[model samples]
Target: MHKSIAIIYNQPAASPYRDRNEQSAEDGVLVEVAAVEKALHFLGYLTSKIPLALPLEQAFSELSLITADIVFNLFEGFSGFPETEALIVEQLEALKLRYTGSPAAALKLALDKAETKTVLKQEGILTPAFQLLDNATLSDFKLNFPCIVKPNAEDASHSLNVKSVVYDYDALKDMVSEISGMYGKKALVEEYIDGREFNMTIMGNNILTTLPISEICFSLPQDT
Candidate 1:
């Protein structure tokens, strides 16, 4: 029997903020959807593409009409509302549908950088010293100089730029304020390690397999 799969993904749209870049930074999702659909077709599985949009109810209504053995969840939430990413997974769970990638709870936890780091610290994992700050809070400078400030609950390097790294309390405060004002969310200030950055992706459950490590090389000025 051929299994049916639904490729659920969010179509890129323009943001309301005029100051923000209007060009769809996430246009790559279209390519990803095409690639996944093609691969699934080659694998002999029936596939359907579902493009999600705002007001979620419309997407859910469309999903109700589809019957698939599994949903290849690619929804990364609307452009600005990153918090809704986990809600998509939760909806799938509520409908008793199996989907790929992290579950709703894990997605929610991971989205909150400070909470995720706290859990890691409790588990004795080595992590940089960090603090969560909102618009009204002042920086205590708990972390060392050359710290990085980022949105607490956003991914894909949202609201991040060269100025995100600060070398002093004043710079940290300005960066934190800028991030909070821009993203309208709490900022996570953490110690910045000025060295090589590596990322490792682990796949599978029970029997785990690690993918090749990837490194990021910066070409811009270090103090930018």
Candidate 2:
């Protein structure tokens, strides 16, 4: 039951590098912002929309002038700048603004696949061994054959499909190259975790509230 300034993010509209062969898609939607704004409106928040596709200084400067009482921080990114997700949250904190959901540091750790792995290791969570393959770093990496390749910072199965599995040196090179080039992000290739995947949702702040555990299943594998 309070007014707030909400920051929201979604992929900016862009035509895929047009080729005569590329068909179009229905324009994407900003579901997160829409749903949050709807809920806040019901709760008496005078919500104002902030469409960000530029630098943080622009948002920060404008927020400095806005009269919103609290910030409902939903900004997942600032347009083309995905790395600045947590940085913007830090800006909000420095500006003495309160927002919703997880903090900036948590967002950054989860957003980055590599850093998350390091933290998992620190917490004694068993994870597949991983190697970061930039143009310069992987010379000594002794990856076993039949490794999996994917873009480092990408989530949502982007650039990951049947072809993402590699069985030889050349296959690894090609998969890494394709993911890095096409996704515009670093590639994170690791030993494929050949196990059942589980989805769990953790809710509530102080008290523990959990939804029933969910299992993720896939079609049976084909013999190579």
Candidate 3:
């Protein structure tokens, strides 16, 4: 018998503050949803796509009604509500539903980049030196120039642009202030390293499978 699978994802919220970059990021999830649905069909599983949005009660109520053997959680969550991603997973757990993707604990931990970096540093894993600035105070700035500033808890490169990368204190201050003012959160300033970017995807829980290393090719200017 083919088992049913529920594919849950966050319905992108439209906001005046969301620019082209943010919209682009949110839109990519639609592509991901289609790809996952196709893959599940090929695997001979009954599939359903559930798009969840604001008003947490409605989302949770919808979740309680799911009748699937497994859930493929593709929820990247909505802006300003980063905790929603983990909360959905937690709900699944409470209902004792089998689901794909990381657990709520891991999702919560990974959402905070500063905390993730601190964990990596404690584990002796080499990571770029970063400072978490809550109020744009550079009085204790110790990192060298050529740094990138990002919202402490945001994903999908939201609010990131050409100006995100800075080479001077003035630019750094501006970027930090922007992140704080826009996201109402701390800014993460990390030492920038100019080079190609790569992603290593690993899947599974009990037995993990590491996929091929994927490199990100940039066609834009070096500064960008």
Candidate 4:
């Protein structure tokens, strides 16, 4: 019998940024859902699309009703609530359903930049020193100048922009305040690494294989 799959995802909405020319950050989820649905169809598996949203119990009920053998688990979270991304996986686990991607605990850890850095440090991995700051404790930040500030629990550069990098204490405070106020979360202030950057994609659980590394080159100025 052919296996069935559910292409779950967080549906894309209008771009929150003022620049209308830019696409929505959630667009990738839709793209992945479409691509996966098509590929599974070609492979002779029945597929269904499940767009996750508010009233998650309703979504969960729908998921349970679906006869799919497994879920692709592309749901990233409802709009403006990136921190809830892991909850979707948690629900899947409760349902005793098979799904793809990282587990809920891993998802939660990866979402919190400060906690992730702490774990990495404990493992003897070289990670930049960082501090988690909120409006109540902004005055306590003592990191070196030229630090990068970002939403503590958000992914996909939710509130990150050119202004995320700060050169002075005032700029750092302002950026941290902006992140906390806008994203409604603590800000992660980390020492900025002034050097080339690269992205390496690792796959597989038992035997991890690193894909080709791609160097990140910014066309804009260094301070931008």
Q: Which has the greatest lDDT?
A: 3
Model 1: colliding residue pairs: none
Q: Where is the poorest 10-residue window by lDDT in model 1?
A: 16-25
How does candidate 4 score on lDDT?
Answer: 0.81
Candidate 2 Cα errors over 4 Å, as ranges = 1-7, 15-29, 135-139, 181-186, 195-208, 211-224
lDDT agreement of model 1 with the native: 0.83
The sequence of per-residue lDDT tens digits that candidate 4 reaches over residues 1-224 is 89988888876665453242324667767777778888889999988888866777777777677568998888887666666688888888888888888889999999888888899999999998898898899888888878999888877767677899999988987898888887677888999988988998887789998899999886879787
Q: Mind giving the per-residue lDDT tens digits that candidate 2 earns over 147-194? A: 899777644444567878888877887787777777666678787767
Summarize candidate 3's per-residue lDDT along 1-224 as a digit string, tens digits.
Answer: 88999999988778533664467677678999999999989989999999998898888888999999998999987756878889989999999999988999999999999999999999999999999885536667889989999988877667777899999988988888888888787799999999989999899888899999999876878887
- Looking at model 4, residue 206 earns an lDDT score of 98
Each candidate: what lDDT?
0.83, 0.68, 0.86, 0.81
Predicted structure with the largest TM-score when compared to the true one: 3
Ranked by lDDT, the better of candidates 1 and 4 is 1
lDDT of 1 by residue, 132-186 (tens): 8865776455667788998898777666778888898778888888888877777
Which structure is stronger by lDDT: 1 or 3? Answer: 3
